[model samples]
Target: MSGPRMTVVFATRDRATLLPRVLDRFAELQSPPGGWSLVVVDNGSRDRTVEVLRSYTDRLPLTALSCPQPGKNRALNAALQHLQGDLAVFTDDDVLPEPDWLVRLRAAADSHPEADLFGGTVLPDWPQPKPDWLCERAVEFSVLYAQQRRPSGACGFADIFGPNMAVRSAIFAAGTRFAEHVGPDDTNPLYAMGSETELLRRLEGAGHRGWFEASACVRHIIRPEQMEERWILNRAFRYGVGEGRHYAGRRSVGLLVRRLVYGIAARGSALLPPSPRRLRIRYRDRWLAGVAAGRPAARASPPSG
Candidate 1:
């Protein structure tokens, strides 16, 4: 594809003060060799987020849309409705990218015609005196946007993260649609998983490929509340359920062993010595592996003769 006309679309609920910092980062992006644009979606905030967003009308073409129904995908689909680009990059307001973030995305899009979706690393803004729990189990949530190169078989899931990922605008011609099958809310009538995770699966199911680019980067702000162990586990559990909804049907036997090991390990990490930063990596992987196995297999162990 010709170097696509691109736009960055961000979604958020609150964090009025925090959102501006990220917006500032987006505003700072330089022109790509082909050019790109930006937009934001407000997912229902009672705070001063709207007032703050209004200040941007003078600096860039930033339109703020209010979406109260919730779900990141809904906000995303709403934002998607406003853009006229060939590529629409979806990120969260909490992530601050380098000055060249958009520029790099355009470059990647320009270079790879086969790449329908793309993502990059999210370096953490670790707090001073980073809490042990954060360095331990907390990094899991913090590093949701962390960078990695995915194996070819699973590039879609490996490169997926709602806070720092992008897709071609052509895919959203229908509106800000979420899979009635998956996304962030188990309680949601439309929830089967998360937007990014489900979207990647759809792209692959539809025969498109998404990949990670080492140079496309973003830095995510780690909120203090996210530093809590309980909060981290809550996020992990939700991630587990989300992963379960997707990868759990095939690969049943392999998933069974891993889920049991992780369930015990997650419980053990909570009781025995505090979890380590390294274990944080295992948290998502374990859940995704077990989840890739699904509810039934996740509930059972591999049978031995």
Candidate 2:
């Protein structure tokens, strides 16, 4: 089969200040054989996000959409109707793709025609100096909502990071959509993440394959506010909660109780010292708490336009 057409999709809310810079970067990106357009869904931003998007209409192949509904997944599902590409590339509103990012993705797709999913690398672009404490756990955590950094290679797992992933349009045609309740909802702290996690896992179980292309890279901008420990801890808590949602079906009430018991023990251990062990213990406790509170499975729903 030939390389399919591509359309990059991303949803944003309330970040009017940063979306313009991202669009500037998109303007610099080189397209693949069939060319690609952009679909930016504004998830009810009270700010001038739509105006900012409209301003860029003459600068790029852009479509500005307004999704007054809540949630990132809802916005994404809503934007699906507007996409006119054989492959849907997903990224964040704050990301900067390399000039050849789409070219590399096309190359990978052309080489691996049998694969239906693709993941790429996401590097961090710190706007200012990164504090040591922040860099300490950076390798383990995305810290800035960038794709999780990993070694260069191909893999079978559907662990595609939301910041840089692509899927065949056919998958959506098969009636699959991102789990409505699993992703971040405009800073709603209670929302369990992993919108792509649940969807990709579903795709993988159906025998669809995925490939990781390291060269198709993008830079995720990290602002100063995210450098604080308080912010990082909150992110960690949400990540743990997402993990709990992933394991919900496999967990029995008795098993969950046991995990919480162990988590409590870990919390006690966390107080022993200020070493790595302490950090690990604290992380474990928060993750377990998320597991206890998060829903095991996503509720199914049709995509809304």
Candidate 3:
């Protein structure tokens, strides 16, 4: 309660059953240097999320904001105006932070006063064992919110995931908000998933420094439905959609043709891998196909100004 004040923010929709546990986890977190509080944005949930949040009112230092709008970014942007700390830390409703999570983040912030962006490690907390096709590769597990594990170090802004990231209040004060159109939305079917990525990239492009705090760890829960092959593939397809959107500014007919050829070849080679590697290859191939599938029209339409 004596260092830098921090505000932890997250947005949730219709996850009432799982929210109490998250709040419980937040209760266990050590306060950062200047003291810390929670701000949760309820993004138009029809379920008992509001009720559950209200239940935690006295137990934790918390504020609940109602965002009638649907997008995750929309809720986050709304929460920004209500933040009461110098540091605004972002995480998802489903993450469990280590008890020392904020302590480590605060340490890094105090140690590196020049950095405006901070990223932390995210490890997957699966409800069940992972299947064989999805081998345990920390570097390749971002799909489940597992960020690359390395010693606490510096990294690109694009490497910052939404589940465990923080930014100085000054950055928001300078007028940066999460991209409205491309993030997770309860009502939107597209699910493009890159609002944080876009925001960090924008900040980095403008010369903001970032740091990665290895000790600031969070366990992202992987539910049973997410373990299913169909769901995983669908997530890959959405990732591909993000890829398409990312390239919208520079997409060309030639680039689209090249993507088509590469995708076809990748699919053809996918038919030949042995069983162990076959599923993985197929997953990648499908993701590539999705990229190609989304590229043509993306290239045809001019990017928005």
Candidate 4:
């Protein structure tokens, strides 16, 4: 039997210099039996992102869309109406998929008829002469880099991340859209994270089953700037904020006390030598602070399909 058609979706912003390599990799992808198409959404980019995308129109099966909105989730929600085929694959502009990426995902979908959601492995594409701190805490900081740790097989919603995941098209056909409140928003420096995780959690809550396709993998480019300690810690804080928003209703006195304790410990760790333990503590502390802040009160109205 032929495999299901796939629609690969991703939103990019101000990555003009890096997008060409990513698109070049996409051009080399081996099409699955059911074929595939790429949808690239330019999310309010102020750089040469538009020109870069247009240059790739002839090299790949690409359809470019523009969403002047700031949030990553809002840009993705806007692409829902253009989605076609049996599966909607999500990834980022900085990721490089293997030639057989879609083939493996399609095969996994064919093998697991019961699963509606599919997650692929995400490995890091580290910069050369990696920083010592990153080398030491690479495994521990996998979550921060969107790296997948789960073994291939049945998995939970938490196992699926934005950099590499897919879901049945029918899910969107039924009116399920990403929550626009969370995710990257250039307008807000403190915007909530977990754009994809929030949606996965909701799907699981509604009884959706997920699968892990170990063979289908992508390498998420870890830019040199991301190697900086400050950038990593900022990501940690945003992650905490995302988690806090995710579990907003479950907040309690105990959680508050824990956050207080973490704050003190994080400050104390700053005086110590640079070590994995100290970095871990600082990361956790920032995250806890974000959790305490919780979700933002003013949310943009969700886009309609």
On lDDT, the candidate that comes out on top is 4
Look at candidate 4 and give me any clashing residue pairs.
Answer: none
Residue 30 accuracy (lDDT) in model 4: 95
Q: Which candidate, 1 or 2, would have the higher lDDT against the true structure?
A: 2
Q: Give per-residue CA lDDT, model 3, range 43-87, as digits (tens).
A: 999999999999999988999999988999999999898777678
TM-score versus the correct structure, for each prediction? 0.77, 0.86, 0.88, 0.93
Q: Residue by residue across 55-115, what tens digits does model 1's lDDT show?
A: 8878876777888776666676677668867888877777878788777777776677787
Lowest summed lDDT across 10 adjacent residues in model 3 is found at: 296-305
The prediction achieving the highest TM-score against the true structure is 4
Scored against the true structure, residue 13 in model 4 reaches a CA lDDT of 97
Task: Indicate the worst ten consecutive residues by lDDT in candidate 1.
Answer: 296-305
lDDT string, candidate 4, 1-305, tens digits:
56668999999999999999999999999999889999999998999999999999999999999999898888999998988898999999999999999999999988998999999989888887665556545325556688786679999998887888999999999999999888999987777788888899899999999999988999999888887778777777777777778877774568778877877887898888777777777777776777766645624221111
**lDDT per residue as tens, model 2, 49-93:** 888999999988998888898899999998888767778999988
- What TM-score would you give candidate 2 relative to the actual structure? 0.86
lDDT of each: 0.64, 0.76, 0.78, 0.85
TM-score of 3: 0.88
Residue 156 of model 4, lDDT score: 91
